[model samples]
Target: MTRFAVVAMMAVALVGCGGDGGDQSQEAAPEADAAPAPGTVTIVEPADGAELDAGPVIFVMETEGVEIVSAGNMDPGTGHHHLIVDADVDWTLPIPNDPGVHYHMGLAQTEFTVEDLTPGEHRIIAVVADGVHIPLDPPVADTITVVVR
Candidate 1:
């Protein structure tokens, strides 16, 4: 046989040997049917309905399925925390930056301190919001009531 014929035959054989004798469809693998868990936020320091001494209250927050990032980081699945104290949130708007009511943790801080809480029951909420201080959709937040003596 000529060298050209031999080379052609070798190439054909190599191509034929590259696949199994079964179906040769190039379909992609099926994606997983399970969906991702929803994001959430929780208060980690004080248990709900707990009474404590009156002083600087330290609030610690935790998040799941989302990362805590500084303000202006509009990346998906990342945001900072907001501590809303004794005030209702207007979910349609961005979280307020007013102190003692809406405390914005724009620095990505997981914990914050509020001093001189009056001797009474107070409602505390930990909310996760985007870089622009807007609360997350479906509102990833946790609320707890605490009493100060």
Candidate 2:
């Protein structure tokens, strides 16, 4: 009789679950079809901990598993670059996106030249972003601090 009561309760619960029950089970997709990881960006020129001459500033960078579209969405395996100048100057810290505090490279990843930096302590940070010019939730890569003299 206890078993019968238990079965009756289950039937009533199911009936109360009206419509989809909100507990749909799903199968996992194959790992081979999983989304690829975002690219890794590293400044190849003006090696980290280097100083710059008094002139235009250029940034050389490389991004893997991402495209370097100059103006558009960062298609699959593609991403773009953004530059932040004198930004509180720290990578261990999140990149600043303040209107005038940051410089965006948009979709370009090639060399960047900034000719108006005054002679003083300045920061040159390069960040990688997905297409549509949006930085990754946590940012893929950030090269911070390149003092200009």
Candidate 3:
């Protein structure tokens, strides 16, 4: 008797859930075919801890499993570079745009040039951020220090 009652209730439930008259095929959100892979970035030029002339420095970088794209939706393996110059990086949010410190290298930039630097030691941090410039949750980044003369 209990089994019969359960079956009857399920039948009524199915009837209530009959196909909706609304559009059911609009389109699904974009989903990456492969699971998100780990990503890494590094500053390749201006060897860390090297001293150089105070004017015009070129920063070269590389990445693995990461595409430097303008900030927007999370495309699994994509983001942009944020070059943090002479200061500490606040990993809590999008890399800032202050000309003196934060450098937002949207449009998938691999290298950036700093035209001038005061003669002194400075720190450089390169961060990879998702579309919209927000650093990934784990925050893929690299840091190096250099001195200018």
Candidate 4:
């Protein structure tokens, strides 16, 4: 196996997830530049500023240059993705895995579903973080809001 493969395997064992089942990383390097282009994150579904009735909030995400991996590995050009429901993020710290609120895609999954949110206006922010869960330098993030009825 390659060095990164080994490291990734180890990270999976060492930092699987917090008790809430969201992979949480609090000890990663500050940033990622291993990818070709400066990364960008966008919501491909539910168009920003959209309105909907009560149901599942399915999000399709778009990412480039940055490879999605476990939050436990600090591979450059590689990082994981997460959805910040109802608010913006503190780029100064590791993104929290607060379950439905701050959802972390530990395995680097590109899509998500938030179900049964109470009626209100909700802001969803997509953030890409390095192996240790720290936001990229200058932070690659995009925000969209949906009003639920």
**Highest TM-score against the true fold, candidate:** 1
lDDT of 3: 0.77
Residues 1-149 of candidate 2: C-alpha lDDT, one tens digit per residue: 99999999998987787432122212223366668454567677777777878887777766654557664674655556777776544434434556446666764645676777677676666776665556655456656566677
Q: Which ten residues in a row have the lowest lDDT in candidate 3?
A: 20-29
Query: Looking at model 2, how many pairs of residues clash?
Result: 7
Error of 1 at 49 (Å): 1.0
Error of 4 at 86 (Å): 2.1
Q: Estimate TM-scores for all models.
A: 0.76, 0.59, 0.71, 0.71
Ranked by lDDT, top first: 1, 4, 3, 2
Poorly placed runs, candidate 4 (over 4 Å): 1-37
Off by over 4 Å in 3: 1-37
lDDT of 2 at 12: 97
Query: Which residue pairs does candidate 4 place in steric collision?
Result: 34-76, 34-77, 35-77, 73-131
Candidate lDDT values, in order: 0.81, 0.62, 0.77, 0.77
> Model 2 lDDT vs. the true structure?
0.62
Over 4 Å off in model 1, which ranges?
1-34
* Model 3 Cα lDDT, one tens digit per residue, 1-149: 99999999998986776433112122222355756546667888899999998789999877766666766657876788888887876677767788878888776667889876788999999998887777876778999999999
Q: CA lDDT of 129 in candidate 4?
A: 89
